[model samples]
Target: MMHLIRLELKKGGFTSYLWGSLLAYAIIACFIMVLYFTGNNLGAEGFQNYEDALNAINTFVLATFIIYASVLLSKLIINEFKDKTIHLLFAYPINRKKLILAKLSIVFFWTFVNVVLANLLIDVLFITINQIFGYVSGTLTITLLVHHAIYVLLQAFGAAGMSLLSLVLGLRKKSAAFTVATSIFIVMIVCSSNGNFNLASIIAVPLSLAVLGILITYLSFRNIDRVDVD
Candidate 1:
């Protein structure tokens, strides 16, 4: 399982994607900071309250991050099948279910860590700027923080499930780009409509997605038993 996990992580291109996501996050942070610091009245209305602005930023960032996980990391699972590497992975002593779960685990863990780190960096920069302007005295409620944390967990799991579903669809249909495009479209539509995409929505969407993926994967794996890999 460890070997499979390592292989999956390597195949997912985490080293490059991680840097890319961080760079994107940094650019966004810089842009937001510029907007916050530039005192010029650009003839546009500003946020009504700090809380409103914070929530807006949080929601947008969270959604974008989830989409990132969906596209960059999760797509690799299906790519492996499209590239015909699954035979190599499954021919070893590792169980097929273990292999599938390993890929899912790596992608999920990577997504969670990346999101948390990105948010932490954003929070630090925002807090630092607020402190510079004597605006860092607001107290945070435990309930609010807990809610945000729960939302983060749900979003990550949802993206993981989406990726797994994408993999299954790709493998089953032998189309990597199609699966990726479909997953991205679904995520965009959900997020654009102001849907929470939280635990409840994830449970509804990704669980169904996972079930479909598992069914496809099982059928494919079982069918592979009768086919020649030469």
Candidate 2:
């Protein structure tokens, strides 16, 4: 399974996706910094402290990661079918279930790692900038750092699970547009809700979505052989 995943990474151009994600992260970090500094000018409620800023940034990124995950699914899974490359994959000596699982594992792992690392980098950069410009209001403490870390990790898992669900939906219909549209819908629903970023909603929403993602993944994989590549 590990070998198969590595092969997929190498052959699938996942490195390019990783680089793109990092670039996106840098852009997001810079945008958040600009927002922090110009909150009053923009007539937005400025972050009350480091915790508030972290939470706001984490929430936005968690939603954005769904879009990233969808793009990865399109490139890694859906494109194989669209391009008629899945026939070659199906011809491999590997079991169909294992092959599909390996692909999903890559998507999940990549999405989760990107979310966690990117958020961590953003937090560090925001803090460093805060130290120099004093734009942010809160002081960083060990306790706060640990709390934010836990929050970011939990959200990352949730984002990964949501990505899987989106992939399954898109792959079932073999439509990249459908897959990405679903991701956009999810982001809209999540961002539009007033409680989505709060602790209770964060824990509850992701857990619910993660459970749904698992069920959908199981159903999708169970019928892998039946997928119509035509």
Best by lDDT: 2
As a whole number from 0 to 100, the lDDT of residue 138 in candidate 2 is 59
Q: Write the per-residue lDDT of candidate 1 for residues 37-84, one digit (tens) a residue.
A: 552235443334344434445544545554565465336556566677
Off by over 4 Å in 2: 40-43, 193-201, 225-230
Q: lDDT values of the candidates?
A: 0.58, 0.81
- Ten residues in sequence with the least summed lDDT for candidate 1: 193-202
Model 1 local distance difference test score: 0.58
Every model's TM-score: 0.69, 0.91
Q: Cα miss at 130, model 2 (Å)?
A: 1.0
Estimate the lDDT of model 2: 0.81
